[model samples]
Target chain A: MIEVKHLTKKYGDLVAVNDLNFKVEKGHIWGLLGPNAAGKTTTMRILTGYLPATDGQATVADFDVFEQPNDVKKVIGYLPESVPLYPEMTVTEYLGFVADIKQIPKAKKREAIEKTIVTSGLRSVRGRLIKNISRGYRQRVGIAQALIHDPRILILDEPTTGLDPAQIIEIRELIKSLKGERTIILSTHILAEVTQTCDGAVIINDGFLMASGSLEELTASFAVKKAGVHIRLRSASAEASALFKNMAGVKDVRPQDGGFTIEWSPGADLRDDVTRLVVEKDMGLLEMRPLGMNIEDLYLKIISGGMPQ
Target chain B: MKNIWAVFKKETKCYFTSPVAYVVIFVFLILTGFFFHSLISWFNTQSMQMAQNPYYMQQININQMVYSPLFHNISIILLLVIPLLTMRLLAEEKKIKTDELLYTSPISVLQIILGKYLAALFVLFVMLALTGVYSLFTFAYGNPELPAILCGYLGLFLMGAAFMGVGLFFSSLTENQIVAAVLTFGSLLLFWILNWAAFSAGAFWKDTLNYLSFFQHFDDLTRGILDTSDLVYYASFAFFGLFLTHSVLQSRRWR
Candidate 1:
């Protein structure tokens, strides 16, 4: 539903987003994962048509952001990083105003506002002035305003930034429930969040797209060879570690306190064979699990290694 | 057009629901009231002291022409007050990052500018309406020409609209409302003070500068002459200011 190609945003001498290209298919949440100043926010802004790209093309629902902005805007609901809201307005009034500006019909305006209030979980505090509400509620109100017109796409920038843990969970759950119905581009530094909430991720560093794929795919890209089984047992010596290393599919084994941790060469399946060997040796199979790489490790590898553009 | 109306209504609602509009109106009324009372006192003193001296004295010094000074004085007050009222029209939205919401909405930049401009103009219009009581008092004291009084009020309102247009342009340039207000005031003062240069600059330059002076086009109406050029000048000034404000906002995305 969204396509960004060769998009670059430059602020004077500094490049905020550099030649980034990506496409978000319909009905999937794409987490834009990046560190601070990673150009994630700049990419989101360009996609929302709030900022013009220095050079490139971006579109939403087949409407070019640069040339057909109103069409693109109509299809997308964007919650900016700062969660801009008029402090003096009550929650209900603010949402109503949003509906009006979004051009919801007069007949549907009230219903749209009510639906957004419910969807955003802001019924009780609808009458409270936004300035008096907590940060969490302010965020919910921002989300509500964006969803008031029920746009097909939701581009949320750090929607959970300042909220407390419970509030974060609540917002995350709300976004999760919104999946399958709308295309979402969620940007945040929280890696675990992308794992739980988004189907795919696009990682960028220093204004460049370092990697982009499913969480597992991106994580696996950093692995030189897939991690093997790490076993913890009652009593085992270096001889036993060597024996395990000599087993099929096992490339190297390191002796631990009571067991040996063995790694497998790439494209090798060692699960059943290692279990058979441990069973035959009569060694306690205590614990054996693959040490899957995480986004942190992959992120550091790409950034510190200075991955090519 | 529907988008423009939508923006207009929302902007108007914002002004009413916020204390900014009330504070501006209250201050405007208080200052205009003080000026009106002073003018009334001056007229009363003149009338009492010259009770028996009737040799066309009233016609010679028609300071009793209450509506003219009231409108003229309101325009002067606008120079100070319009900036405060308009400083946050677009700037605060950018500062708080709400400009994204508006800019990404379906409304055009022209719609947003006109919406904000009309909202500020509405507050000024309401202030003008509230001061109608002073005109009633004018009628109570001495009969003034209704056409002249109306012409003067129209001139003042049009001039205030022009000033507000300029304030909106300055507001679009920065995110800080305070900075916008200060810059708008400085620019308005420069235009107001341009007429002073006429004394030193001789007739040719004087007239040239006079055309540029905001208050110059306003003079004919304040003197009870409704010149079409003066009317066109104020209208064009307002149009130009709003157009520039729209362009500034549109260019901001590229910057």
Candidate 2:
């Protein structure tokens, strides 16, 4: 639903987004992952047609962001980073205003606003002024405004930022529930959020595209370098560490509390071999589990230029 | 068109919800009332004294003595009050980050500028309408020339709208509403005094300064003279102000 090619945005001598390329397929939730000031918001702004790019092109729902900005805007709903809102308006009033600006027909405007109020779980606070609401409710109102038009694509910048833990969980579930219905581009620096909510992720650092792929693919690619397993045995023995180090695929073995951790060579599945050796050697095998690389590890590896081959 | 209306409705609603609209109207009514009452008392005393002399009675026309100065004073009051009405139109949007919502929407920048400008004009219209009660008082007690009064009001409305457009443009240029208001007031004050330069400057400079003074064109309207050139000047002034606002909004995309 969205394609960005060689997107470069420069401010005087500073480059905000440089040579970035990525694609988000329809009905998939993609995370634009990056740290603060990593140009994530700038990229989203360019995609939403709010800001013009210095070079390259982007298209949303088959409309070029620059050439057909109105069309692009029609198909996309954007929630800016700060959750822009009119404090004097009520939740229902604000949503109605957004519905009007989004060009929802007058006959269906009430229904659209009511539906969005229900969807964003804002019915309870629909009559309250926005300035009087809590941060969590304000965030919900922001999401409600974005969803009032029911556009095909939703672009949210840091949707869960400034929320309590409970509110964060609720919002995460809300986003996850929206997974298959629309194309979502959620930007955040939270690694766990991407792991928990996105089908694919595009990692960026210092305005450069560090990596982009499915979550599994990215984890698998990074796993090639530091793949390992942790085994907890009933008995700790120096002999077991020596025996494991001598194994063909085993690269190193480190003794830990009550057991040993093993690192293996790339493209090696030493689980079965290690299991058999542990059982046969009577080392009292208690627990054996493969350690898959999480997004934190993958992010660190990519940012530090240790990209998988 | 619908987008503009939507924005217009929201903006107009916002003006009432906040205290700005009430305070502006209240202050305006009090000032205009004080001016109207004093002018009427002075006119009554002068006319009573002139009643003794038949020659002077014909020269003391109520329209000249009352409506002309009334409308002119209202116009000057509008000059001071318009910036307050327009300062928050665009500057507050930028300060609160709501410009993202506006710019990213499907609406064109021209529509946004027109919608906001029209909303400020609407507020000015309401304020003027309330002041009409004072005009009704004049008609009730004495004979004030209806055509001159109407023409004076039309002139004030147009000039006020032109000044509002300029204030809206200044609001778009800054994120601080105070700065926007002060700059708009300062610029309007400069134009108010531009005619004074005509006395010191020679030839070309005098004509240029006189032409730039808003009150020069407005004076023609107050005298019940419907000059097409004066109408064009007010219309063009408002158009240029809105045009500059549109350009400012468009430049933000590039920035």
Candidate 3:
């Protein structure tokens, strides 16, 4: 539903987003994952046609962001990072204003506002001024404003940033409930949010694409590139460590608390040989463990080792 | 057109629901009423003296002595209070960041500007309409020239709109409402006093300053002369201000 290619946004001497490329499929919630100042907000703004990119192309629902901004704006709903809302306006009134601006027909404007109020879980505070509502409800009001026109695409920037833990969970559930028929690009620094809510993610750092794939694919790709295999020993000795290090097809060994962790070259298996040597020498090998790449592991590996080849 | 209406409705609703509209209107009426009472008292005092002489009595027409000067006073009051009406129009939206919602919506920038400009203009209309009671009082108590009073109203309304347009541009230029108000007041004051600078200038510079001065264009209308030049000047001035606001918003998006 959305595609951004070579998107670079520069502000005079500073480049906010550089050579960024990512795609989001229909009906999938994709996280734009990055740390602070990663150009996630800038990228989202560009996609929503709220900001013009310095160079490169971005499209929403087949409309060029640069050439056909209004068309792009029509297809995508944007929740800016601050969750901008008119605090003086009540929830329903705000939604009605959004519906009007989004060009919802007068006949269906009320219906659209009603549906958005429900979808954003803003029913209870619908009559209250946004300023009087809690941050959670205000956030809901912001989302409701974005969803008022029922656009197919939603670009939400840090939708859960300022909420309490319980409120965060509520927002996450709300996002999860918006699962079907909406292509969502939710940006966040929170890694766990992606694991729980996003089907996949385009990970960027310092305006550069670090990795972009489903969870399994991202970890799997990193696993292949970093090392093919790792063996863990509950108890081991210096002799055992030397044996694993010199063993054919073994890459390196890292000794930890009463244990030794071993990694082997890509497409190699030295587990059998290492096991036989430890048994013959009667070295203390309490247990054997295989290292599986999780998200945290992949992220650390990328940060420590630089970009994957 | 629909988008403009949508924006207009939202803005007008904001004004009505808040105390700002009532407070501004109330304050404006009090000031104008004070000015009217004092000017009319002076006019009455002068009329008694002029009553003894035919030529002086003819020189002391109500339109010249009261309504015309009242129109000028109202325009001056408008110059002060219009910033209050317009400072928050775009500046408050930018300060609160609700402008993001408007910018990302399907509505064009031109529509947003027009809708907001018209909303302030509507409040100006309300302010002017309430002052009509003063004219009715004159009609009931004295035989003032009705056409001149009506023409003076037209002049004040158009000039107030022109003030709103300038105020809207300044509002668009800043996110601070105070800054917008100050900038608008300063700019309007500069334009209002341009005619003073024209006094010492040669023919070419004097004519340029006179044409550029906002009150200069308002002069004909207050004289009960509905010249197309005055109408076009006010209309174009309002349009130009909105046009400048549009340009500011569009360029700000790129940044």
Candidate achieving the largest lDDT: 2
Q: Write the per-residue lDDT of candidate 2 for residues B145-230, one digit (tens) a residue.
A: 88887888889999998998899999999999999999999999899889998999999999999988998999979888889988
Q: What CAPRI class is candidate 1?
A: medium
lDDT of 1 by residue, A96-194 (tens): 778888989999999999898999999899999998999999999989888888889999999999999999999999999988889999999888789
Question: What is the DockQ for all candidates, taken in turn?
Answer: 0.67, 0.77, 0.65
Stretches of candidate 1 exceeding 4 Å from the true structure:
A216-223, A232-250, A255-260, A264-287, A292-296, A306-309, B57-65
Model 3 steric clash pairs: none
**Residues A95-127, model 2: lDDT tens digits:** 988998899999999999888888899978999
Q: Which tens-of-lDDT digit does each residue in A183-206 have in candidate 3?
A: 998999888999999999888877
Q: Select the stronger candidate by lDDT from 1 and 3.
A: 3
Judge candidate 1 at residue B94 and give its lDDT. Answer: 86
Ten consecutive residues with minimal summed lDDT in candidate 3 chain B? B57-66
Global lDDT of each model? 0.84, 0.90, 0.86
